[model samples]
Target: MSQPLTGVKVLDFSTLLPGPLCSLLLAEAGAEVVKIERPRRGDEMRSYEPRLGEDSANFVLLNRGKRSIAIDLKAPDALERLMPLIREADVLIEQFRPAVMDRLGLGYAALSAANPRLVYCSITGFGQHGPRAQEAAHDLNYVAASGTLSLTAGSDGAPVLPPALIADIAGGTYPGLVNILLALRQRDQTGRGAHLDVAMADNLFTFQYWGLGNGALGQWPGTGTDLVTGGTPRYQIYRTADGAFLAAAPLEDKFWQRFTELVGLDAAALDAMPPPQATEAVRAAIARQTAAHWEQRFAGQDVCTCRVVGLEEARRDPHFGARGLFSRTVATATGERMAALPVPIDAAFRATDATLPSPALGADNPLLDH
Candidate 1:
C-alpha cells in the first residue's frame, strides 16, 4: 500500500532529540528523510553509554526510518553537494543556534531562493530573535526559562527534572513537525514556502495551560497547590505496602465517588476532611494494601486509575500490545529487530505491521539523481 508522504524528501540537519524526532516522524509517514550529520563522529547521541552495544538506544530510536549523510558543514565542497539535494527537497529542518545556517550559507534566505516551495524549519532553545537566542542551553535550561520547573516536583521536595525532556519533545520536535506540515499544505496552494522558527521554551508555557491560565487570571496558586501538579486527592499517586505504586486521576465526580466507594470511605470521614486530608487518608489506605491487591480490586471498575508503570512494564502492557503500540521492525544497517516508533494517524492507517529502518551514514546521497 502507498503511504501519504511518498516521494516527499526531507533534509534533516537537526541533532539530539528535537530535530531528529521531528524528521523521524516524517520518515515514519513515508517521507524520505536524509539526516545530515557532522563527519567522522556522527550524531553525538550515538556515543551515549549505558546501552549494551556500539549503537546508543537513544540514537537508534530517534534515527530510525531515515537515511544519514555524514559531512563537514564547514567544508566548501559539502555545501555544493548539499545544494543540489536542497533544490529537490520538500522540507529542510535544522536545530542549530540562531544564524548558524546563515553562517554556513544554508539559511532559509539562501536555500529557499533555490527551491521556493521548500518548507524551512529551525528549532532552537529560545526563539530566533529573542534576547537569549545566542545563549547556549539544553532541555533543562529551556524548561527553567519557560517557568515549567516551578510547577514540577512536590512542595517540600527539591525541584526535579522530569524523566522526559518535555520541552524538547513536546515544544520543539512535535510543534516543528506540525508547523512544517502546515507550511507544506500552505505551499501546495500558494506555491511558496515558509520559514518556521520553533522555540523550545515558548511551547513550555503553552503546555502548562492550567498554570498559565491561573497566572493570567491571577488565580494560579503557589507551586504545590496547583490542581494538575499533584495538588488534589483526585489526581495523584499513592505508594502501596509492597513498595510499588498506583496512580489515580478520578477528576470527574462519578469516578471519585466510585473510588471512595471502592476504598470503603465513611460519610463522616469524607465530610470532615479537606482535599489534602482526603488525599492523605486515601494514601494511607492505599499504603495498607499491596499493589497487586489494588490491581485486583480495580479490575472491573470504571475508575480513571492504574499502576505506575516503568518503561519495561509499559512495553509488556496488554492494552498497548493489543493495539500494536510498540511494533517491531528490522534495521537496514544491521538487520537488527527493534521497536518501531509509535505514531497513530487514524483507524484507516495501521501503524504496525510495517517494516522500515534508519539509513546507514550517507546511504541515500547516491540516490540524489532519483
Candidate 2:
C-alpha cells in the first residue's frame, strides 16, 4: 500500500525532540523529509549520551528515513541557498524561538511569499505572541507552566517528575503533525498555505480537560485527590513485598469487585470505608504478595490490574513482538543498527524498506545546488 504522504516534500529545521519527532512521523508516512542542520555542529541531540557510530542513539532513532542538508542559516546568502528547496517544498517546520527565523530572513511570510503553498509550522514552548513566548523552557517547564504538572503529585503531595517527555511529544509534536496535515488539506482547497503556531504549553490543557471541567464548577479537589490521580483505591500503583509495583486500575465497580475478591479483601468492607482507608487496605493487600505472584494471579483475569515491567522487559514482551512494534531497525552512519523508535502511525503508511541511516553533515547538499 502506498503511504499517505508518499509524494510530499518537507524541509525540517527543527532540533532536539518536538519538531524532529513531527518530521520523523511524516517521514514514516512516506514524506521525503530534508533535515536542514547548521554547518559543522548539527543538532545538539547528535551529541547526546549512548553514542551510535558518529551520532547518538537518539539522533539515529529519530532521524531515520530522512535526508540531511547542512547550511549556515546565519550566513548572508543562506536564504538564497534555501529558496530553491523552499519553493519546491510542501512543508517547512522549524522549532526556533519567535523571530529567530525572521531575523535570518526565513520566516513564514518570507517563505510563503516565495512558495504560496508552503505549510510553515513553528513549534515553540509558547505561542508567538504569548507573555512567555521568549522564555526559555524545556518539556518539564512547559508542563509546569501549563498546570498539568500539578496534577502528577505523589502521595506526599510533591509533583512527581514525568517518566516521559509528555509536553514535547504530545503537546508540540503531535499537535504540529495534526495541524500541518490540516493545513495541507486546507491548502488543497484554497491554493494557499498557512502559518501554524504550535504552542507546547497551550496544547497541554487538553490533557487536563476533566480536571478543568470539574474545577470550573467549584469542585476542585487538591492535588492527587482526583479519581484518576490517587483519590480512590480502585486506580493506583501499589508496591509489592518484593519492592516491585503493580498498576491497578479497576475503575468500574464490577472490575473493582473482582480485584478486591482476588486480593482476598471483602468488597463490602472496602465500599463502606472512606477513600483513604480503602486505599490503605488495598495497598496492604497488594504489599502482602510479590509482583511475580500478582503477575501470575492476574495473567488471564478480566480485571484491569498488571505488574509494572521495566523497559527491557517491555521491549522483549511477546505481545509487542506479535504486534511487530519493534520489527524495524535503524542504522547509524557507520552501519551499526539498533531497534527503530516506535511511532504511532499505522504500519500500512510505512514502507517496509523505509529504514535509512542518519546522514553525515552536508551529505545531501548536492540536491540543493539545483
Candidate 3:
C-alpha cells in the first residue's frame, strides 16, 4: 500500500480505454483515483462483451483500484458539487471530444482556477489544436494518421487492423500517465501545475521513434523497408509447418550467422535476401519442420529467435513463469483469479502492493460525498 503516489488524489473523468487506463495505472501505483461517470449508465465499457458474471472483463481489468461516482455533468449545480473535489485533487484526467468539457463548463481553465497545482490532462484522438482537432476518430484512424498502421501489415498485403488498441493505451494512456507524474513533480518544485494535451495521433508518431527519427534524418526511407520495420531478413517472422510461426530478431552479425546456420541457409543467401525475399526463404526453411521441432532446434541458441505464441500459451510459458510475469488474484465479484500488474518495481524502486480487489461502483463512500 506504500508508494510514491500514495497521498495523491486523481479525478478521472475519462471512459473506455485510454483515460480509464491512465488513472488505473496511477491507482495501481497507490494514488487514490475517483472516476466520475454519467449518473444513469456510468462508463459504457461496463457492458463490453465477454462478461465476468455481470461485469465485463474489460471493465474489471481497466477499472481496478479506483472509486466511481455517477454524476450529472449537465446539471446547474454539477460544477459546484465537483469544485470541492477538484480543489483537493492533484490530477484531473478527461478524454471527451475536443469541446465537450468546455460545453459542460468544466474545462481545464475553469478547473485549474480552482486548484492551481492540479495536473490537468486531456486525452484525445487528434489533439487540443490543429485542423482536425475537433474531428471524431477511433484507434485505427489515429494510428493511420501517425503512419504506424501502414507499416504493420503482412508483407505485400493490405493493412490489417491489429487486435490491440495501441493508439489508445500505448499512445494516449501511457503518455497521460507519464505527463501527469511529471506535472506533479513540477508542482513540487515550482508550486504550479501545467496543462497536458495528450493526443493519440501525436503519441503514435512519438512511439514510432526508430522510424520517424531515422527517416527524417534521411538515414531511413520510412515505411516498412526500415531495418526494424520489416526491412531486414534477420528481424522478421517466418511461417512454420502447419502455419505456425517462428520469430527471428537476430540483428547482430553473430546472431544472424547462427540463425542462418541453424536454418541451413547459406550466409551468402542473407546478403541476397531483402526482407521480403528473406521472409519467404525463411518461411520455406521453417515450413520443413513443425513448430515444436523449430522450437527445439532454436532452443539454447543465441540467435534471438523463438516460437510465436498465443495468449494462453504465453501465460503458461516457462520463461514467463520463471520471470514471474503473471501473478494472480481472485476477483471479488467472480472469485476467479486473474493476472495482476506486470511492472516490477525492484527493491531500489518503490514497491507498493497492487493486490487489492477491484472497486465496486462508487466503493469509496467518503470520496463520492465530497
Candidate 4:
C-alpha cells in the first residue's frame, strides 16, 4: 500500500528528542526527511552514553530512516547552500528558542517567501511570545511548570520525577506532528503554508485535564489527593510479599467489587471504615501475597490490575509481541541490530522494509554542492 506521506519532503533542523522523534514519525509514514546537523559534532545525542557503532543508541533509535546533511548555518554562504533544499521541502521543523532562526535569516518569513507552500514549525520550551519564551528548560521543568509533576508524588508527599518524558513527547513532538499534517492539509486547499508555534509548556496542561477541570470549578483536591493519585483504596500501587508491586486500578464499581473480593476484603466493612484505614487494609492484604500470585489471579480478568514489570520485562511481554510493537529493528553502522523506537503511527501507513540506519554526520553533503 502507498504510504500517506510518500511524496512529502521534510527538512528537520531540530535535535534531541522532541523534533527528531516527530520527524521520525513523518519518515515512518513515508516522508523523505533530511536532518540538518552541525558540521562535525552533529546532534549532541550522538555523544550520549551506550554507544551503538558510530552514534549513541538514542541517536540511532530516534533518527532512523532520515538522511543527514551537515552545515554551519552561521557561515556566510549558508543560505545559498540551503536554498535548493528549502525550495524542494514541503515541511521544515526547528527546535531553537525564539528569534534564533530569525537572526540566522532562515526564519519562516524568509523560507515561506522562497517557497510559499512550506509548512514551518517551531517547537520551543515555551510559546514564541510568552514571558518565559527564552527561558531554558527540559522535560522535567516543563512538566513541573505545567502542574503535572505535582500530581505524581512519592510516598513522602513530595513530587517525584516522572519515568517518561511526557512533556517532550506528548507536549512537543505529537503537537508538532499533528499541526504539520494539518498545515499540509490546509496548504492543499489554499496553496499557502503556515507558521506553527508549538510551545511544550503550553501543551502540557491538556495531560492534566481532569485536575484542571476540577481546579476551575474550585473543587481542587490538592496535590496527589485526586482519585488516580493514591487518594483512594481502589486505585493505587500495592506492595507484594515478594517486594515487587502490583498496579491496582479497579476504578469502576464492578471491577472494584471483584478486586476487593479477590483480596479477601469485606466490601461492607471497607465502605464503613475511614478511607485511609480501608486503603491500609487493602495494602496489608496485598502485601501478604506475592506479585506472582496476583498476576495469576488477575489473568484473563477485567479488573485493571497487573504486576508492575520492569523495562526489560515489558520489552519481552507477550502482549507487546502480539501487537508487533518491537518487531522493527534498525542496523547500526557495524551491522549490530537494535530495536527501533516505537511510534503511534498505524501499520498501514508505515514502511514495511527494515528502516535505514541513522546517517553518518553530513553523509549527504554532496547534495548541497549541486
All models: lDDT? 0.81, 0.91, 0.80, 0.91
**If ranked by lDDT, best first, what sequence of candidates would result?**
2, 4, 1, 3
Taking the tens digit of each residue's C-alpha lDDT, what string does model 4 give over 1-370?
Answer: 8999999999999999999999999999999999999988999998998999989999999988899999999999999999999999999999999999999999999999999999999999988997899998999999999888887878788998899999889999999999999999999999999999999999998877888789889977565467888878888889999999999888888888888888988877887887778889999999999998888888887888988889999989998999988889887766767888888999889988955677888988998998
Clashing pairs in 2: none
Question: Is candidate 2 or 3 superior in lDDT?
Answer: 2
- Models 1 onward score TM values of 0.93, 0.98, 0.91, 0.98
**Candidate 2 lDDT, 1-119, residue by residue in tens:** 78899999999999999999999999999999999998888888999989999999999999998899999998888889889999999999999999999999999988889999999
Return the number of clashes found in candidate 1. Answer: 1
Give the runs in model 2 whose Cα sits over 4 Å from its true position.
none
**How close to the true structure is residue 366 of candidate 2, measured as C-alpha lDDT?**
97
lDDT of 3 at 13: 92
Local accuracy of candidate 1 as per-residue lDDT tens digits, 1-370: 7667778899999888999989888877778888888776788877776442456667877887788888899997777888888999999999989899999999999898999999999999888996899999899998888878877767576678789888899999889988988998999899999999999998888777877777789887566576777778888889999999899987887888888788777534764688788788888888998989999998889888899989988889898999867665636476765776676454343334467666666666675444
What is the Cα root-mean-square deviation between model 4 and the actual structure? 1.1
Per-residue alpha-carbon lDDT of candidate 3 for residues 1-370, written as tens digits (9 for 90 to 100): 3677889999999988999889877876778889898765678887789876566778878877678777889989888888889899999999988879989988888877888998999999989999999897899898888877777766565778878999998899889988998899899999989889999989887777777678788875444577766777877877888788888898888998888899899767767766677767876887898888888888899989988889888888898888766653426454654665554334223334435555566555365465
Candidate 4 local lDDT, residue 319: 83
Clash total of candidate 3: 0
Q: Give candidate 4 regions above 4 Å deviation.
A: none
Weakest ten-residue segment in model 2 by summed lDDT: 352-361
Highest lDDT model number: 2
For model 3, the superposed segments whose C-alpha errors exceed 4 Å read: 217-224, 272-279, 333-337, 341-354, 365-370
